[model samples]
Target: MTQWPISDAVEEMPPGLWIRRGAPPPMFSMHRHDDVEINLVLEGQLHYLFGGEPLTIRAGEIAVFWAAQPHGLIDSRTGDMCWVHVPFSMVLSWGLPEAQTAPLLSAQPLITHAPELAARIAHTAERWGEEVGGSDPGGTADAADGPADEDGAEIALLEIQAALRRILRASSRARPEAPADGGGSVPAARLRQVSDMAQFARDHHRSALTIADVAAAVHLTPSHAMTVFRRTAGVTLGEYVTMCRVAEAQRLLLTTSMRVTEIAEAAGFGSLSSFYQHVSAACGMTPREYRRQAR
Candidate 1:
């Protein structure tokens, strides 16, 4: 076995979005960052200690997770892998349904096996690796494709998002959840309500939204709505709402010149103190510090 590298302390992942194709590195420490991380194992297998659980991602499998949770590469058979890190705030901008967003934030790795999509996914990753100057210690890029243009970066982002959606679909199909309704074949009927409640939260997070308002949007009583959402999403409705607001604040801090006070209001935080507390908890830094790190 390869010797473990360096310390095992959790380190903060630097801010930004990036794509890379390379050999898996030896990691002895668990580290975290606030981004949505996707990994495609092209050859051999990659092992990880993710969120205090041992996970093995074999070839042709793609794993997705919230990087905010401490994770590290523990072992690997000689293999090539592609990695994509999308800022958490940017993922919220995608406004994906709760069914999809919930798992990413759940601090658990979502692994899906889709051999049918492997070749295409690998091709896209190679393209991105070339375009973004991804550190390619593995030398996996196709020589014929050459380097990609600046515009390729934007296109890569869209393709990555699409790939995530596809992976989520495969995951859901693989593990069919029990319906909220007893023994009902159509889980969508109740599941749709959960999705709607999440959408409502995202759409109106900037406003003073109550459980009553979100429940009303989906036509469910507040109590029932909360129950159903927690069961399905593995998170409380209020937690999701706070997630939405924090995501918006992250986006503003990264992309705009707004002051902390203005950003707090713009992102729908009821108070500056509340905003500071949440941002620190989520990003492990103040709004100003997060922006500076990104630079």
Candidate 2:
């Protein structure tokens, strides 16, 4: 197995709606981001460790998961793959019918084998990678370029949603349901602001981040930012930032041989005690216990 060198870019944060295609990077540290990720295996098989659970996807299979949960490519057989990351906030704003959104929001990935759709998704994803300037297999190019234009971005989003809906349509566990009226729409401005704020938090959580900092990034007052973020995202700004920290700690605990104190600092915890408290509350186990179980 080959472990690809971790780039500084990869260590920082995930970019908005991005696509990349390349040979499988056999080793990856556990990491999470606020996105709905779609992975298409073009050849061979790929194995993953997601939140301590094992998952495998073979050629011609498409797997979609909420990337907010910790996941990584722990191992794999040689293969080419395409990866797509859609900002979760943007996905939420789309008001996708409950049936489509439910499966993505859950911890388990929605995996489907459809060789027919494989070619189409690959072509589309490749085109997206080109537009975003992220076609490099090593993932060195910056994906923050996003779409060349707003129109292009919207088209990409529509196509991705359609692909997901089609996959959901083929699933035995899904049911037909209309999108809820109130849940079906959000103002474009509100969506953009909330997405920006959420993305800012994800990008800066490994620092001394605060609600005010998040609000400032979006040019909104702290009070208004908190209100809108809570209403739109269904989570408090503070809670969201803490969630990011806890996730980072979990990843480091299981994937790296770092001491608990070192991991706490790396994950942006203010103190060792605070790290222990949050990790226990989030995982129902101490850091040492969690690491021991993984071992």
Candidate 3:
């Protein structure tokens, strides 16, 4: 298996990596990482494949993706991936609050991950994205072109990490809180279907997807299957699977030096424009800009 893509734009902060500017979409097909990554999409839709599911990450989304596991995106509808990507190796070395890291690394595939906090991080990244992607980032009052300010950029990263911690913790508590029957005794037939849907995403996020596709995997109606997906997992089926795809795409971009177009295709992006849009929206920077800045 290919190793995760490493952003050329990483700022060495001891053992941790502060990766900015990611390679364009279609960056990597399948890969793994040495560090965990967190992404706050600031632009369009980001599709991720993880743990046998396809998760769609859209603008105004805060998601925690782990590199400890293999992941990548096969496709994206958004033009560019605009967001913040952080590696877990940095989190462990930084010695920041676990309240900051636990929630994100939790067992669940995905969660709110601190919705409000994520929103705040999104705002900061969006500001940086607009400036960084600008023709003249330096012309602005905020010092747009000269690379993100030392204070502002680091703060944004901290906030993103902290929020993930919050989300992870909150979700963990919820598992205990779940009604004894929440998981209930899922019929073996339904259980098998859910398993199959999960497998389908793991095997086929690059192909075209629809609710029907997942539902059919279990021999159920799309609506019924979606209901099952949401009940078992807190997120909707579409949301769950999209998250997986986006996770996959992000890892590929960070671990390899592949061109955005190549990454986008391998990641399963239907089109370059869509790949850029989703990757930008998810990572908070265009693929080219991500690679350039990562350097």
Candidate 4:
């Protein structure tokens, strides 16, 4: 275990994608990707020293991490790793339909470790293989014989997002009333800050609250605030707030008979138009549709 560097000039992730399995006993030189990274140990335990913290991920589990964080994994037990890297821009764009990506781009990160994500990942990887390999099962073929790499990559990325939606939906539904504890209170303090800000957002999302307002409460600069919020909790401050309000509205929509406008206002919407826009954007439909689906 050695220290890898962080906070470099090449901090931003570029907009391309790559996926491959690690060859056993091969430890790539210690370095970070220029994008967000997701790694799952498929067949054995993976010992990782990341962000100066010791973490050991077992088989059947997954891990999402910032591409900028210093990290490395080795197989003392099996020396094997399976991994995927997606650019931050790609992830934010992928989070929404292609037509609506501009407005949804976020300056944050996302990470998770759930066993259920594995199957979806395997499906994506298989699609990638077919889309790139051209499926001829032929012995000899040129690079052009494969499907266009760009198209194949796009399909794979979309599948990754589909899996993420399921995982995130389950997560939001099972969101703990309180934040969990770990990460040495270093991250925990920021997590608590995010929780406090979330509570505020839940109560005041429609109030024209600004990033500055939220950052002030937590003693971080607005730009810095967004980074801490996302890296710590896997969503942007704005998205987090929006998620809280919409989730509350969902609860109200399902449990009570309030009209959508009233429910929106109660959930911190300043106007029916904004409420409709946000709810529709977060989900693919209007509040009425959301409520109907909830039922």
Clashes of each: 0, 0, 77, 1
lDDT of each: 0.71, 0.70, 0.53, 0.53
Q: Decide which is better by TM-score, 2 or 3.
A: 2
Best by TM-score: 2
TM-score of each: 0.57, 0.62, 0.41, 0.45
Tens digits of per-residue lDDT, candidate 2, 55-160, equal: 7889988888877666667677777788887777777767665445545644457787876677678777776665544433235673545568777766766777
Candidate 3: stretches off by over 4 Å: 1-171, 174-189, 291-295
Mind giving the per-residue lDDT tens digits that candidate 3 earns over 12-118? 22212333433233434444443455565545566655532345676655566554345456456544343344454445445433233333333234444344555
- Regarding lDDT, does 1 or 2 come out ahead? 1
Clashing pairs in 4: 75-79
Ten residues in sequence with the least summed lDDT for candidate 4: 98-107
| Every candidate's CA RMSD | 12.1, 6.2, 15.5, 18.8
Best by lDDT: 1
| lDDT of predicted model 4 | 0.53
Pairs in clash, predicted candidate 1: none
Please provide, for model 4 over 45-121, each residue's C-alpha lDDT reduced to its tens digit, 9 standing for 90 to 100. Answer: 76654422335777666655545443444333553455655665555444343212211122222234565566457
Sort the candidates on lDDT, descending order: 1, 2, 4, 3
Winner on lDDT between 2 and 4 is: 2
Residue 242 of model 3, lDDT score: 63
